[model samples]
Target chain A: MSSTPLPPAAELARANEELRHQLEEAHDLIHAIRTGAVDALAVQGTEGPRIFTLQGADQGYRTLIEQMNEGALLLSDDGTVLYCNACLAGLLQCDLSEVMGRAFADFVPPAFRDYWAGLLLKGWESKSKGELPLQTRGGALVPFSVSMNVLSFNETATLAVIVTDLSAQREITAIRAQVEEQNALLDRKNEELKREETARLAGERAAAEASRLLEGISQIAWTVDPSGANTYRNRRWYDYIGVAPGEGPSIGRAWRERLHPDDAPATLARWNESLRTGAPFEVECRIRNADGDYRWMLGRAQPSRNAQGEVLQWIGTYTDIHEHKLALERIDQGQRELLNYNEQLTRVNVDLDNFIYTASHDLKAPISNIEGLLDALLTELPAETVAREPVQPILHLMQDSVNRFKRTIELLTDVSKLQKEHGLPTEPVDLAAVVRDVRLDLEPLLQSTGAQLEVDVAAAPAVMFSEKNLRSVVFNLLSNALKYRAPGRQPQVHLRARPEGAGVVLEVQDNGLGLDAASEQKLFGMFQRFHDHVEGSGIGLYMVKKMVENAGGRISVSTNLGIGTTFSVLFNR
Target chain B: MPLQKLTCVLLVDDDQTTNYLNQLLINRLEITDKLLIALNGQEALDLVQAHCHEATPDCPALILLDVKMPVMDGFQFLEAYDKLPLPEKAAIIIVMLTTSLHPQDVDRVRRLNIGGFLNKPLTKEKLNDVLKNHFNRHLPE
Candidate 1:
């Protein structure tokens, strides 16, 4: 990342020359006017305030004092303020008389007051120009660069001075460098901590002398040369293999000869390939231990090669992983058992569903007979006479049981319907015609109640389904909307279908006596009816859900307690 | 025109109550002289097929079916009915009555060429309506 070099010194000097020339012109004009060689045009101008000068030099001096931008102040050798210009008085936020003789140290902020004090001594003792600090009227510590000279203009040691504010430049530079240094120090500490943590947690601190370090580990570490021979062997490997370290015929082809007959061929091939390619070798093989039992050992090797990629030596380590191998065996067995268990659960679920549907289907007729018998018995007896009779109440109780049985029957039927709802042939069916048919079917209720039923099918999209099922869904939902329309709000049911993502969005919204939040949970539950005032088997939504689900679709509801409810169903394409 | 009574009626149902009530109702109306009972659609199909070739016309004239039955329901019966051999003497009029609140069942009955559907607890009025509109037994002279 090379950067462009800045301009040469001569070009910078030329720019500096131009700037100094401009500075000299302004400086000389101010000095000459301060000597009162000319009239002050501002005083004689038409618009300015009237000023009468007794001496031309005094006028020029006043003009120069007003024009100077710096806060100029002159102090007596005895530390009294001899003169203070308007700029200086404004800077101090005080009347000229107040500051004209005040001690200068009182206004400078504490942090830089010593620097100002030092510079004050420099004027009488040694060099007269230096950098100092001052406190603004607002109490801010401001740094100023001062250039002063001991002068003989009035036959006394009057001063000629120039001051420049350097506070902003200095603060910007100091804070930036300080923040960068702190960040760098924090980074260095974080890196060292990271290294120490890695050393402690991962045991990854490397050793430069490999042979001396490998001597202390539980793992069996050794060197194997390019030819299928052990150049060295660790004591752990010899002990585990039921062999003495040096009692073996020198660490040669003896180990390979000791490899179990089953592992020898594959191990020899992998080793030869590893040496040929100078690739790291890793393998898990069983070895006979001192206890006369076979244990799984994970072997890994790093090949040290010369410049020609020729093998120098191979450092190999072996770790016993018999426990891990057995755990994997156990996991495989558990997975097989789990698969068998899942199959059993599926079979049981199907059996349960079948039992429910069969039992409910079988129970329906007897319960129906009880209901019909009770109705017949009631009709045979007098209605008014049975209003209080014990037998009548008992019959009513039977009827209640019969109703519950019927409800259970309905639920079982719905569940069976859900199971049977598969593979329905679909094609585009006119929703408008379905809506019209539903309207015609509900005409009697609409006419009797004078519920203003409006069917707006012009904007609805025709979705695909079995026309019979779709018609029923539309009719039941519309009738439900009309039946449950909020009392006194002029029952308005809006059934609109439109194209939505991957399907049709059918929204049946109504100004109905909306269901409470508690009831909303079981809104689509079989035999769960929210409002008893309207005639509902409570299976409408359940049936609707079955139909939609069977069609690979979904339906949902949103409602406000007193205001309204909307049932929006989305059918998949 | 003269009103001719059915010789025998077939009652097919998995439920004994529906069979009994429908039998009683048919007997009370004197719509048939003999009532034959079949537990399922397969039985109904077999019985009707066996009696289809009657020499002296002592066969079932009407068949009442309960839609939700085990083994073989009304729809299954209709599916099997098309295959069963029946004679002109049988004059079999298949009528479906189900307790299913689903409109799909009613639509399915009409579409499958089954006679018709009515609410359960089969009534005399419903039977009379079925006879008048479906069979139109008393044809105008």
Candidate 2:
């Protein structure tokens, strides 16, 4: 413990430094007391020690701090809690006494401890504010904003801190954020509704266009459901039916009320079948028009089907067919009249034939009787009277007349028989054989006329014809060729048969006294003869023509005056 | 040779001229002692019934029949003759004479029980054929 002696100047500086240090210590003590870092102060007096409270010294200011909605607290420079109001204690869920003299860093949650240190450092320089969550006595966290300032109190430097509980303010901010997110979601939903509305509008426009097209058609169109219930009808349908739109009767009622009685039952049955089978319906019937007259109408309906072949609807139309029906009926009536006329003509022809036959037959008896009586008279006459020259000539003339009469009667009978032979049974007749037989029958005539005859039937040998008729036809042609021989020239005749088309043509050609055009026109007619010198009853050619034509055959004559004549017969097999 | 003479002969016809001619022919032939002449089949039948009531030599042995009469025809006369009560009916010869050889008449004549059919103006040759065929006799040349 020896001390070195200093100079007077050094000693004086030392004394000054010591006095300054003592003054700073005194200032710190006063700051702690004023800021309530120390609740009471102890003083040393001559007799004893005395205590003095620093709390509630400014009663009015304390009351103001307690009454404020915000929590109030005081923290020291070392981050220690010096004083806390009732609101701060409530935020911390603790008593005021628990908060006093406690480290503010201890009240701060671990997640906010670093933030609290930063605020304290900044507060020592001037003023600082920060937010942090504080842990309460019940273990719940409370949000708080702390404002710290470096201030001098009682000549000592101290930190003045004000703590505000921020729990309510943070809850308001979270609610506002939720409201903003809900507004964005509502805006997206509104956009989707707008798109759906546009699509629905387009579909409605398409349906309206289809309805307009259906209305403009010319037909009496209408539509119905699959059940045959009428859904729509065109204006034409209403006009045609003489009814207003929506005023037409049901289909079943219309069948009875508007349709002709004769056509109603059939039309209804057809319509029901179409509805039940989903088939196309077509029918012709008579319907009553606006003028109350029945007219023919064609009704048609078709079902509209889906992809699965399900009937969606039925489309129908009614067309007026009255004019066509009437025309057909007229044609049928005309045909019937024509048939009646033909039958009458046939009957008249039959009657003519029968009359001729009877006349010829009756005449035969009388002619034969006259012949017999003449013979008897001749036998009974005296020899001298019979031998007279005038008597002989007269008798010869009478006999000749009787013979001619008999020939005429026979020819007449043959002509009458032609009609009855028309339906005679036919067989395949050999043309060559028939021609040969005919030639033999006409051999005398051929020899007398010195006619040349040529036959060629090999090309078509057979014909479907009655054998007797065929022979008669050939004989008549050959005899006519010989009978009508030209003066001073031999008659030349040719017979030929050939196939033409589906039938046979038999031709007889003759070079004789041919007829002129006018005579040729009636060459085959009954009682028509161009030459009078021949022994003919003028019925041979007529019978030939009739026989040829009776069996689906035809006869034609071609002749030139003084040149030649040809007769052709076509027999259809 | 001349044929055997018949007991009686009958002629049936409608026309007066035909009946007279037939009678003259029969008379000229002289083939029977009795010659009967009638205008129609009904008269001929009456003559037969009156003269040939029994099997007698006076009964007609041959009869000539004519068709086309007003009351009765050749076929009708034949029908009545077939039912006659005369016992000599089967022994008599009958022939049909007509101007018409129409198919219907010819066919009907063929089906009848008559001896033969001849065409008119009854010639000697036709009568000879009838006599030779039915009566086993011939006409005089």
Candidate 3:
């Protein structure tokens, strides 16, 4: 506060320092104001340094200037807003022009409007400064602080108000609130994501568990489409069949392809019926497995149906039943064979029983004719002439025939008797002497027939049997040998006995009209004979065989027709 | 049909004594003097049928056939006789006579419409027994 006076050089220097100091203060203020929104730089006119002051002038700019300096808004009495700044109005989404001369109460939010008026009244009366919140048009609250002072200006007194916009100043307080809201939203979203992930994980776990359970099912579970194609299978089916899993399906065929030829038709028929009827299917068949062996198997299946009652697939299982099927077949075959064998045995028994009956009936015609002829001849012959002359020949023939018939009947009786009595002749006998006697007895007939008898009685030693039966056996054999003497050749006979094991084997071989193969088999029959033209009864040889058999011996014959015949008698050792 | 052409008859059998006696009885009847003679049944049938087919036809009015004979039996003669047809069935008289009494032969002979049946050893008395039944049936009708 000094008056103007100075030397030109001294005055210029002092004025320059003063002007520089004032310029420095203005630059600092402008710098501080321009730092946010209000530009406070003031340039001096070249003529002189100027001093200017405006009261209640451009309150919006002033307030803006204060707000830029980080200050609050000030309100006047009567609920009138004295000023607002660019920062406050802009944050309120309100125009600076609309904020000027506006009633502060009108600017208040409806909820806070009364509260604001009361607080302002109290603040003005008490001459206090209070912090308040103001509503922006964006519906956000802007914080502010106002100082009230009574002023006497012009004629009446009004409140001298100072406003400080605290929008940025309150920003520090609201940071925690923003952080809390963001954290809440983030937490909610994280929870939702966690729930979704858990659901997805549970689904995956269920799917895995289902797959594991599917593997544990051991049945040869197989699926086939309605079109008769295989789609799926379990492990046991292939394992039981001894084939590679899925091999049958891979070959463009179903598992039925492995069935044996004999079983294929039945298996296919059952399957076709099942498919047509939508019923359960079952079959047993032989399967040619991978190991190249055929095994029986049973397959059972049922159709899987959809909600519409349409068949979707057939699910089935396979089992091994070869042993059971084969066993049943074998038992059936055995029963059939047994039945056939029993039938044969019954037929043979009937034949054996009927043989004699049938033979007698057939032979009676000739035998009765001969009997009638004999009766007639006997009637014609005189009682005294019965033994004489021309009648003698007829008598001889008839007598011989009667004798043959009587002998044959006796032989038949002996054979039948042999069958029942198996008692052996236990007496020891000289088989050698008996055979010699037989040769001597047959000497006359043998000479007439030109038959030679060679006896080898020493070969078998002594045998146990009735000597009388043995003599008859040898005599019947030698006489039969002479009777069967051949036409062109003289008969040579050999009768021999040889020791065999613990007994004797007697053989009589004759060179004569030898027995034919068919006649040889029948040589030992009751009245069997070779050469119907030969004289004497057929029973001579027959009785001889019966005696031998009754003596615990066996009889057999070997012969070459047109050569010699041998009759063998084997006594058990 | 005429008296001079009165048909003759022959009977054949193996029993010679039966044949002689039957001839003696037949001569007494005088049915024909031109008597044909044969022993065996074959020769008898042949001689009788041979004489029958002659132009002056001496068809035997009666042939006494036996059921049994030697060489060829009476049954064989009956079989051979079946092959022949009588020119005049009334003019031919054939009779089966035998000692054989088998039912099968009795049934067989009943089917033959012969003159009459006469038993063996034909005497006048038994012959009259036959004349009563046969001679009455053979008259004009």
Best by TM-score: 2
lDDT by residue for model 3 over A1-573, one digit each (tens)?
267665599778999999999899667656655563343212133675322222334658565465574433445455544455565566557776676557766656687776666666767676767667767786677777767666543333445445566766668669978988999999999999998688557645543444355456765567676777766666665665565664644763356667788989989998989988988999878877657688887888888665567776677777777788899899999999999999998787556434433343333333434554465567567877986777878788887886566455444444444433446446877887777677777778877887777888676768787777778777877777777777888788888888989888888899877877887878776556567798656667767776787787887888889887788888664
Residue-level lDDT for A569 in candidate 3: 84
Rank order by TM-score, top first? Answer: 2, 1, 3
What lDDT does each candidate get?
Answer: 0.72, 0.78, 0.66
lDDT at A443, model 2:
86
Error of 2 at B95 (Å): 2.9
The most accurate candidate by lDDT is 2
Candidate 2 chain A lowest-lDDT run of ten: A37-46
For every candidate, give the share of true A-B contacts it also has.
0.29, 0.71, 0.00
lDDT of 1 at A79: 50
Model 2 interface CAPRI class: acceptable
Worst 10 residues of 3 chain A by lDDT: A36-45
After best superposition, candidate 2 residue A393: deviation in angstroms? 2.2
Candidate order by decreasing DockQ: 2, 1, 3
Which tens-of-lDDT digit does each residue in A493-519 have in candidate 1?
Answer: 777788887688888888888878888
True contacts kept of 2: 0.71
TM-score of chain A of each: 0.41, 0.58, 0.32
